[model samples]
Target chain A: MQPLRLGLARGWVTWRSVNTTREGLANTIIWNALPLVFLLIFRNATIPGTDISVGVSLLPGMLAMLVVFSVMGTAYYLAAEREDGTLLRAKAVPRGTAAYVVGLLTVAVLDVAAAVAIVLVPGLFIVPGVPLGDAGMWLGLVGYILLGLMACVPLGVLIGSVVRSPRVIGGLGFFGITGLAAISGLFYPIAVLWDWVQWVVQILPLYWLGLGMRSVFLPAEAAALESGGTWNTPLTIGILAAWAVIGFVLGPVLLRRMARRESGAAVAERRRQALQRV
Target chain B: MATTPAGPAIRVGDLRMNYGRHEVLRGVDLEIRRGEVVALLGPNGAGKTTTIEILEGFRTRSAGEVEVLGEDPEHGDERWRAELGVVLQSWRDHATWRVRELLAHLGAYYAPYATASHPRPHPVDDLIATVGLTASANTRVGALSGGQRRRLDVAIGIVGRPSLLFLDEPTAGFDPHARREFHELVHRLVDDDATTVLLTTHDLAEAEILADRILILAGGRIVADGTADALARQVAGRAEVRWRIGEEKFVRPTDDATAFVRDLLTGPDGAGVVDLEVRRTSLEDTYLEMIRRHEHGDAAAAALEPAVAS
Candidate 1:
């Protein structure tokens, strides 16, 4: 119980530092700026044969993509901290690793929240016909975002625990997430893709996250652009919940295994290997 | 001096550690009494860190009866862990955290384990002052110099007020002033709180200054273990004496320098003797000699009694 409290304090400290530090602030800007620029470029352009502007349709997909990026960022930070001996330090204290993981998850949740706020607040002004006056739409937005995080964050942590080095996370995590986003229809409609490709993307959480976001943001008529020509709200919730269940069950076990293997010499060896790589 | 209670802070028997087919610690044995400062001195691959890590419960041993604070280190629980403080050779772990903040956060884990006799989590301000990092209490760890960062590591290590502290080369990269200050800090801990310390180091002088007993490890075994003076005397039994008579000089090794000097003055050649000098072997020489003898498989050197045996 004390460890949990300490973990909350740890999360608070890390969140404050990450948002306030110069490098951390810069990373947040660089990540969100690229998507904002893309949104502005297509603000006036409408989807072919539809009253919906490209910006309005792209905003929800962008939010989903941000969830994926936040998960990848969590994994990358875990691997890098392992290389830098932060995890080993945690392992030394009583119940330290438990606190460390909780702290990380807390900070990651807050980070994803900040990112969502950054895009959605500005998105209302730039995108035409945004349904801001509806409180129900805002509530749905909050629900899907929360559900999306529950699915993605644990999977990210599992990958972080399994990967041997930070370098692998950097190259492999980036390409893997980007590849999933492409097939999940983050940038375009999945209905326009091959039928087999659409089926493949449906199994992943990224697609459901984007679909749920679209359900809240896009008008009812815009549902015609979806693969099934409907929002399929029930399927979206089920798939995301299923992914969350698998992640929560598997994430803790793999994390414990990884934490058990950590020692001072292991960290030192990793640091040595990292230096040699440069 | 506030002597430690009548029990061993750490005990190990036939401790062996093997990585793949290669063995690192081979049948090593040691016992550190409560409140005693014991230094593990060895060459680069002498298994100092491996032994420390094993005792800290961070690594599993291949074959051993290892006990720290009356519990098997491999199975030490959170309560057991709260009593043990470990100072690892940290590089850049908590870079963005301020010194005081890190200590307080790390120390919070020990709050529930606090007892009436010994309170857990030393006050952040006091710990900062104890390690002489008061000025940098608010400074981010990344902004600290190498020496100040090492001091912060020490503060964090002792924040829980551990009864048994394991410091693996705490002063390795420290400058002379920082090293001296670190030694004084260690002394204060031992003297004031009766905290037992087991540190590893390549510096023989540091071992002599900080340790009540020194264990010389070579070839995966403790070759010699005793007080600094005791080990020096055990390995080299004599002091070297040199004198000049007329244009010739003579050098002689003696078990008793005072007696030898008196005998020389009383003897026939006493008047002619000039420029006399006596040199006793330092811990450094004894350390090097013991390591060399252990490597060469000398039977007598390996037969010396350890600190616990004495």
Candidate 2:
């Protein structure tokens, strides 16, 4: 029952996230709001029937990209807590890992909620009826974004389990997200890419999320597939399910090993070496 | 007659912790019996924390045997964790919650509030008062003075009222007054709950006052484990009787101070014995001597120093 350990860790992480966002607001405001402007403003002089002219073709991919970028932030929080002594404290508390995962998931869900309000709804508003055509279509839009982010849980846990330093994880953050974004067709459709590029993107999980998300928003006339390049929503979801299960199974095992690390000795040695340098 | 309990409450026999080729705890063997507050005294990197963590079940040993509450800590469960309260020196360093909130929250993790023996959360006010942090109860941990934060750490450790408490450098940041108060609190807890305490401290004075027995560790092994008086007898055990005689202050270590004083005052060369002070070897001296002797590889030879010097 001792939920306090979990509560405390989750609360601290949430507070840190809010602080980080507030500190970086000047940059985030520009980066976050610009896509909305492009979607609505560029529609003034464009063709109605064609996908590229009205920004509809770009809508699904952009939203998929938004989900990916935002979920990456939560993963960063997990890695940060692991590096800091706070995670070590949690390891000693009762009902430890089970309680901790519950708390982390709570934050993940809330973070994804913020992503929906910030990215999905606003982007849906700009693209007219295509992204939010009816009740069913809007529901699908929400569901896929949630599903895609949920699918990313395993990769996030794997990263959090293996990484020990915040600086290295932070340094990798941009490349990790953007590299996946490039291959996933966040800015451009994978269908328009060269043969080798498409092959590379197809195998990555991001490509499936992008494709599944696009299926909900764009009309059937949007992209012509190369015979077997057919979009399967169930297959997209299945891969995510596999990833989530793998994470659920391996996260604890990896964390158990990491938790056994001699935290005090490590901290003491680092502090010792640091003093020696001084 | 009260028969003293025999077996040690905690027994670490040839315990070893290894990280590849680096051995942190090199076969540490120690025992703390019932009704004893044994202070584990050592310098940094002497495996004090590793030993404590292994006993608390936070770390597993690479070799040897350990038993806390008669169960191996590495395999100890929630039930065993509930039996022992650990006041880690750095448990709450990164916390931002209020002092009171942190203590109360951690207390919930262990209070088997409905036990057939003693039920209910260990009184929070009692713990807060014991650690002398009543005034800083509501203060955010971030805003707390270092001493106050340490008091809260102590409060959190005993929130569940465990039968045995493991306090690692509990009063490191406390002021002199607060440290005394904390020592009294340990005594009070022991009296009230019969809590067997095992504290580790660098402050020898603290060990003298709070510990019924002191266990000195060096190179990951206990070199001395005995009552203050027994340990004091390790080096220069006899009292040094000093007195002013005419223009000279004379000093001599004597086993029988009364007889020596009788002889001094009754002899024909009788002189005035003013400012007379009888001083026994202190706990600090014994502890230091033990460590010195252990490091010097002359345990048998060095053990002869106190008696001969006397």
Candidate 3:
């Protein structure tokens, strides 16, 4: 309980610090706005055999991308903080690690929320035919975002713990997420890809997260164009929850193993290596 | 929490650590009493960091019996951890955090562990002043000078008001003025809380000035352990005797400086003796000789030199 409270405070402090900084603000704006630019470019285009604008169809996918972006963000922070000795600092205090995890998760969630808002608020005014009047749509949107974070944050921690270098995580993680997005049908229908690729993407959380977001934002008529010719709400919920469970189960084990190996000498050796690289 | 445990603050017996085939600590043994300031002096790559890490439960030893505050560090819990303070060599962690902000956040973790006799967490403002960072209390850690940053590290270490503190090369990169201030801060801390400290350093003068007892680690073992004066005397009980007779100057190394000086003063040239001086072997010389003999594969000879002279 105490660790949780402290972690929340730590998370708030860190989030505020990052958001208030010019670099942090610039990063948030640029990344979130990139998807918005795509939406605007296709604003006048309509879906094949439908009256809905392409921009409206792409908004849910953009929201899903924001959630997916959090996965890489979480991994980047974990690896960077570990390299910088912040993780070891947490280990020094009583229950500090617990607080650190809570704080990290808090920041990750807040980042997703901020990114989602940046795209969604302006998106609401620009993209037509979003069922904003329906309360259930709003609830479902919030639910999917929360579920997406739960599924992704733990996977990020697992990746961060396994990878020793932040540069590697940042570089590889960006390409990896971009590739996943390509296959997960964030910008187009999965039916257009090969059957095996569709099968592979279905096993991952991003695909389900994007499916859940589409269900909430797209009109019922859009379901006709989805894979299997309908929205599989149960499958989307089940797959995302399963991914969340797998991540929660495996994340801590790897994180603890990585943490157990941390010491002052290790940190020093890493610093020496980092300096040599520079 | 009120009733402090009774016994040595730290006890290690036959502590051995090996990295594959390379043995770092072959067989190390030492004990530190409560409230005693002990310095672990060793050369680079002498397993100083390894030994400290094992004691701090950050590393596992291959073989040893180790107890820190009456519990094996290998299995020490959070309660055990709260009783210990570790001052790490900082490398840009928490840089965005303000001095006061970081201290208060870290200190809050100890709140539940506080006791009537030994309060957990020294006050934030007071701790800032203690480390001479009061003016920079609100300043970002990244903005601090090297010396100021080191002071903040110390402040963070003791913020939890730990009963036992581990300082690993606490003043490594400090300039002279910063070093002096750091030493004074340590003195005040010890005077105020009687906190048992175990610090590792290559600085012999620092060990002499700051430590109640000094342990010289060479060749993976404690080659010498005693007060600075005792260790110096153990190394051959030798001293340099210098004097001037008219235009001639004389210098001689002898095991018995007092007797040699007395005899010289009362001898034939006693009336002419001027600028008389006797200088005992400095800790630096003793440390170098110990390291040299050990490096030459004369461990027995080096280990015996101190006892034989004593």
Most lDDT-accurate candidate:
3
The window of 10 residues in a row where model 3 chain A has the poorest summed lDDT is A12-21
Candidates 1 and 3: which is better by lDDT?
3
Every model's DockQ? 0.69, 0.26, 0.64
Error of 1 at B138 (Å): 1.5
lDDT (Cα, tens digit) per residue for candidate 3, span A1-278: 99999999998887877776788789888988788788778878988888988888889888887898787888888988887888888989999999999999999998998899889988888788889899999999999998999899999999888988888888988898888888888778999899999999989888888888988988898888888888899989998999899889999999999999999888888888888999
What tens-digit string does per-residue lDDT give for candidate 1 at A1-278?
Answer: 77678778998898887667899888787777667888899999999998888998899988998887766877877888887888888888889988998888887888888888888888888899888899988899999988988998998888888987777887887798788888787778877889888888888899999999998988999888887699999999999999999989998899888888888888888888888999
Q: What is the clash tally of candidate 3?
A: 0
Provide a comma-separated list of chain B TM-scores, one per candidate. Answer: 0.88, 0.79, 0.90
Q: What is the TM-score of chain A alone in each candidate?
A: 0.96, 0.79, 0.97
First chain TM-score, candidate 3: 0.97
Candidate 2 or 1, higher lDDT = 1
Displacement of residue A143 (Cα, Å) in model 3 is 1.0
* Model 1: how far residue B78 lies from native, Å: 1.1
CAPRI-wise, candidate 3 is medium
Write out the backbone clash pairs for model 1: none
Ranking by lDDT: 3, 1, 2
Model 2 Cα lDDT, one tens digit per residue, B173-218: 6789889877887888888877789998999989889988887777
Ranking by DockQ, best first?
Answer: 1, 3, 2
Give all TM-scores, in the order shown.
0.92, 0.80, 0.94
Kindly give the number of clashing pairs for every candidate.
Answer: 0, 1, 0
